[model samples]
Target: MVIAAFENEKNLPLNELMIPLDEDGIERSVPALNEKWKDSRIFTRYTSFPFRANTTLVEEGAALEQWFSETGWFVKDMEWLLGLEHYRFWSTLVYNRGAIESVVSFTQSAVPYYLAGAARSSPSVFPLYSAAHRATLQVICRMITQRESDRCWIGKEFLGELLYKHYLVSIPLLFDLLPVYGRDNKQVLTLMVQTIFKLQPKYGQDLKVGLKFLQSTFKTIQQQIVTDRLDGNIASLTRLNDLAIYTLDCSTVLALLVECYPDCRSICTELAMEQSITNFYDNTIVVLYKNIHAMDNESTYLTYLNTARMELLSAFRGIVNFQLETVLDNPQRSLIPADKFLCTLTECLSDPVFVKDYQRHYPVEQDLDVLRQACRSVDTFKMDFVQNAYCLEDGANGLSNGYVEPLPEDDESFGEAAGGVAEDELAEAGPSTASGPVLTPEQQIEANVQKVLDVLPHLGDGYVRKILSRYDDVEQAIAAVLEGNLPPDLANADPTEPYIPADKLDTLFVETGIERLNIYDGDEFDVLVHDQIKGVMKKGKGMPGQPKNLKEMLDDKSHVREMKGRYQEYTNVCDEYDDEYDDSFDAMADSESKTVRLTAAMRNALVDELEDDDEDDAEVEEDVGQSGGKKTLDFCENPEVVRQRYEESRRSKFQARQGGFVPPGGGSGKDVVGKAKGQGQDKSVLLNRKQKGEHKSSRANHNRKQGATFKRNKGMIPS
Candidate 1:
């Protein structure tokens, strides 16, 4: 009962903490054993670790070596070491500081033994030597830990001199032993690190140095992964796992530094320490997670990489959660950079392949919830950020790979728009083909353009293609062109050609022309109707009436009077126009431009102040209200200078585009009408005849008079 009560006491108040002090304020010597209980006393289980009145540091180290080197010796050292929590009963441990040096030597010696046990890579307890190493670690940690009894603790001024100056603790040694044992056992390591700050808060700088080295190591591994350095190697998994361990080890400890040491959080925030773990999460974990399927035969090693990813994020959350108000010197600013953390999650979570397993093990939503709760607690959250962050609508919504479900009608639309449906969706959607082998959309579009161009021979091929691309239906585009309703850009094209061919001018009015010319085919209107009201009769050609000549067709203006009311609505609007002023835009314009309204007294004061101020001595900028930004006079450039600058900028951008850009091949078929097959025919006719000829039987029209019309003499002006 006495031993249990004695061992369980901890976290005592500073006033309650004490050690025996003599009248001279010096510790009194220990009295010898009582006479009656001397021989029948409690057996000393750790006699091998004997310490006496005159043991030197060298002698103690040798004793610890002897005790550890021999197997099956004193196993009670760990127990006795753990019992030294009573500072008053064990004043000699602090006063006689050689035991610290001795334990450190033993801990160092036990490294080889611990490594031997760890080599099995099994989930068993460490070997005896490794256990001893941890025991020594506890002893050292207790020594450095700040005592509740302020009278007995080491002064911060002498802490660096005694520990660091003597080379007892360093970044290399701490990290070496730390990563080795810390993989399974972090409590001991955590204790030691915490004690380090308790002893001297300034050691946070040393911790930062170690963290920097780890972050650099993490970056190197990330770069190597990005470059696929281990792609084909047999030992790739092993090498990668080792690298992950090395970097993740230090990354985790960074959080420990911020957590265990209070001042270091602010110090590290000044150094932007959050980016270390944040970058590791982004560049390493997220990258590897994305490419996990590629790790085929070596997935086990990559599993640890995923776990390391979660660990890194946990550290990130911890940093953000523990951020000091003065970390940014602005209390309202969020510690979590939403762009890096919150929005990135939204992007990564959209892929069910990643989210399926990730959500299963580490519920990303829970972490986000924790962040939300933390923000509310700290009063530093962005509502827009929290509201926009990704979340599972139904727990099972995105688990399976399927046709993409549309983004939920939720609040997140205000922020990062959810990623689009899969990029290959169009490729998967069967093309415009009639269900044989499917053609690509591009091929279908090209075929459609040629079909439109074929029937509209007067239209430029370029114009037809433009029309086809805009309307995406050959029939509709052809119909629109036939109705003389081309879109604005295609309006410049000559849809109607001249009736006379320039090259055939000599035959325009020859003596045999009117008598035997067969240029006029049949009248487009009914021949009976043409005979009743229009041009010459067609009885000369063994028909009821002759086709109207270009001259007679132009002179027929009967249809114009039939469409007389087309513009009446527009004319009425013009006739009703009145010069009325609009005040609707006044309020909107006032809001957009700065409008300062001053009270009468304020205006008088402003006038007085301006009058008192010298023009030469006036300030260049003034504190602006409402806009919340400074109003400064930026010198205006001369128009010529502005023009030169704009030109230079424009030229540079143009050069860049020209250097790297490849324009889409021109699809327009302009100016192919009256030229040779390649040079004279309009793109419409050339494309229509040539391109369409590939599919249909041009054998029937092979003997037709193709270019004779274009080569023949054209009519005089229609009128």
Candidate 2:
């Protein structure tokens, strides 16, 4: 049936092809397979049968390859088979093994092709691909689990080859398969962890994929730890720390991966906080410090440093508590080199470079206090431990007598002690003592005063002087500071000049000639100045009537309208005079005779007089017009007599002008208008006179009694 299936490869069902097995269900010998099968034509035809068609065929094939291993036929022919671009065939080979060496060798040799096929496989055929993936993972896991103790190293070597060569392809496969493998499968989990550790030292693009795979594996471990409540897994912790240290070594890769994947940071943080793992805490601190140092973002650096600091504190507390417990439990073993640990921790916490960098970025007080406390605790512990250790060492050395022979003066120890004392003195003296003579008390005081003088510019000179005078001694200074006493100058300062009271603020504005303070009473001024004043004034203590000021009185819309109206009236009067003056001046300048010319000042005087006369005439006309014909008998005898007198006076003036006789008032028409011919009295004056005469005539006519008669008189005429 197998031969027939191969003969009709295109026609027969691929599943029907299977290797012939004996009654025991083991693969039968394949003696018939020989040199002829090694040829390309026969090999390709034989290997074309699908390996997944039957499990027996895969096992039988491996047996056949083993049967011909001496002739090197399988090795020569399997190369062509592996090159056939068959995922199922390779998966089958992975599923069924002949020799460990042959299987591992074949798998390693075919990893690149498998990865390429997996990469090229379509999503539609993902089920088939997943089956192949499962088979591959099971094969690797089996090889690792089934290996002998002496040959277990081969498993790691094989995994390294697979991972380092095919990291990109393996990453997705591992991620997809990790959850499927589950934490229940300890062997597989161990193999996965071992595979990650092997890939740690690798560099290049593959290292990043390896890191992602490791991160995913850590997440799996984390979940398992949570699910199983495995608080302390030393092996897992060690592996995690190893991975972190490896990542730290490749800082650029770690930074890129952590930045791209925030979970990487969480994974690292978890690994660092794993107290079960040896040196995990310290490793985490170093890694976090390195990451913070490398990071440029202030916020990210602060976040990392804070986490590290918390972990450091926890670690310190644990170490101290553990040491104390150890001492309580076994005094002899209590000497746990805690002083060294404390010293190392102290050095790390007090790293001047880190302190400078940290302060440069986030100079918060609480964070600073945290570091100081850590250092102080370490210092106190170290001091106590040193004293205890010294007494213990002396007691152990049988020096409890308290009387010992001193080393000879010229002995190396004595000389070294002397030198150390000298160095200590020099260190305590400081750089200034080394560079210059020490200052006396007076000189030190003078220096302090000079420093105060330097700062006096910022604090006003008067204020600083007053403070100095009040706090003459340390006790007074302390009392003054405690009481929050102000300087004498400020304490005695007048309040009125500093801030204008609300009610009187408007007076200030008025004095400044500002008629409209309300125009400035908007949010713009409030933002620029008012808000600041309010802040300084404090709540409930504002300048009496602040904010409202004179806005209510000055900003009244009705008052604004009245002022506008008055301004408009004044402008109209001025414009009217301007026009009249301009016209009069032009007329005078155009006259031919120099006698009629008027200087600018004279012209202005004439314009003013004319304006006054026009106003008076208008007033008089208004009164007479409103009164109508009603008049007191004493004020006016009769309207007809009054009209006759006005007509006689006008006739006499006209006759006088014709005869070249100046009026008794010494006024002439020529002086008012011009002496030139064709020019009569000023048109404006003439118009005014005409209007008045017409008004009078109309009034007289309206009041006339038709039957009444009157006699002409010197001052009156009858009508």
Candidate 3:
């Protein structure tokens, strides 16, 4: 039926779309799709709706929106809607679920274009009509609850994408819708709270910022409540009543109030009259418990609630028990059995029925031990005694009535005195013990006040400050307000109103020795940072002006010294680089001596190697000639003699090149005179031979003289 309705609205063929069915739909026009959808059992386990199908559906809506606008069907509706308040659609959608989604999707989709149009306007005007917008909100809300049974999740991006584009202008407008639509729409309230809870899992601090914004809107809602009541607007009142009921979702609104602002109780109390405020809190708790019960199958939600409940109970117990403890401490004061209240709860908590039910419903074990211990303590207190205490029937003494033993009557008053009193009877009837002392109300109050002082710091800074300031002027204000000791004008004065006039504060600044805090024109106060630092300083121990320990002082000195050393090292590196630049300048001026010597040495080595190669080639030529002319001579007859002749020939040829004079074999310059001078002394050749020939020729001559003593040298002419 739903699929058919959707198809009929879109004018689409039913054959293309697969529709899931229950056993009931038999005579439907596209029965095969329904049959297939059902037989497939796909509905039971959908992670996300198929994207192709979703896109097709969205395209159908786009076509529908376009067709309606072009054909002037909704043009009239649009014109009409444009003129009504933003909430007009919200109201309309509350009655009709089919139209709810279309309107929400349309508004969310159209917001950007509207904003764009607004921006282009001479003086920007929002395109949204408030009434129609609100009506659309109601429609969306109706859809959320109606569709919840199907578990048809609306992806968060559907809202996020719209908000992302138009947040600057539309966020405040979105906030306005909450006040208008949230009051009666429980489903919408739950959806929003759940969404916030999802976000809070990751970005709690950001969620707090969002919560603060939402909380401020509650103020406007309070004003609207008053306005509607005074104007006798029944429609508005009914809407507001619906909104208020919906606002009870896990007391999310109340939780936000407490979280965003500390004085939320007083604000909410004032908004809800004195009598109804308590009912509001009770209703909120009912909503919380209902949600808790709803998640019985899952342990997570139960655990969260159980943990939270335990924390609250523990804190309350701590406050009450401490009061009892203090009352008992005073010798004059009697203890008020405040512990009885929790004792009963503790006993109930330990009962298998309560524990099993609590565990089944809400299964968080955050501080179960503490909760169990509390229960155990209460269990030790007799149930009957607890009931009597709750009834306030138990007096200072354990006796039923507040009674004391009558003093013993004197024997002289009686005409006949007792002959004998039995010793055993006297002993048995002697003053039996009475119960412990009971505290007076005044002492109880004092003990409670002391407990409150101890609990103050835990409540947060804003709460502490507000509480401290509330009764600062009690002496003057109380007598005037309560006792009628002062004028009626003073009696009705607002406590929050400043005691000193603003003008007087300025005058007093000059009159007293105290100087008003001077803030420079350019300076901005960092109150948050200042508060953080003040908190740190406040927690510090010892005399305020006292010096640190010797170790701390020495460590501080070391730290300073370490930093100075690092800085000096950095400066030294910088100075070294500067010195390097100066050295480079001096190096440029005295560069020629080393460059000239190095060039000459390189040239000489190249020339000498070339000359040595030539001498070796010449010797090879001479040996070849001698070998050709050999007449069956044995070259190895005297090996050392041949070696000495070879050495002499090499020395004689090498000496004639290079500019230096060389001896042939035995005398100075003898080798040059005998075999090398003039015949090979070309100046260019001498330059080429200098490095290779000089050392080889001198060493060769020294060897040839030694060879002559061993054998007659054939290659060397006597020199």
Candidate with maximal TM-score: 1
- Tens digits of lDDT, candidate 1, 1-719: 01112221344332243322243455443221112111221211222232221111122466545654542232354445556434431343333344434444454433321233332332222355445555656655655554535344434555544466555566566655554455555666666766666656556677777666766777787877776845753335445556655555555455444444445555555555555555556556655533542444234434445545555555555554444233234425545543334544444543543443345445556556555554443333443444333343334532222112233344233122434433344346545211223448866665665455434433454555567777846778888877878777677755433223233323534522533334432334334324554554455434453335768668877778777767555566545543343354666676799878999999999987887685424433333554468665658858997888886666555556544332233222322234554455554456656665575455446534443443453543242
- Which ranking of candidates, highest lDDT first? 1, 2, 3
Order candidates by TM-score, high to low.
1, 3, 2
In model 3, which runs have C-alpha deviations exceeding 4 angstroms?
1-134, 145-179, 191-477, 481-719
State the C-alpha lDDT per candidate: 0.48, 0.39, 0.37
The runs of at least 3 residues in candidate 1 whose Cα sits more than 4 Å from the true structure, single-residue gaps closed, are 1-127, 145-156, 176-191, 227-235, 255-263, 286-300, 324-382, 392-719
Higher-ranked by lDDT: 1 or 2: 1
Give, for candidate 1, the lowest lDDT window spanning 10 residues: 32-41
Q: Give lDDT tens digits, candidate 3, residues 515-584.
A: 4455521123324223333322333565554445777655565568779977887665433357787898
Worst 10 residues of 3 by lDDT: 41-50
Q: What is the model-wide C-alpha lDDT for candidate 1?
A: 0.48
Question: How displaced is residue 213 in candidate 1, in Å?
Answer: 1.3
Q: How many clashes would you count in candidate 2?
A: 0
Total clashing pairs for each candidate = 17, 0, 40
Can you give the TM-score per candidate against the true fold? 0.37, 0.19, 0.22
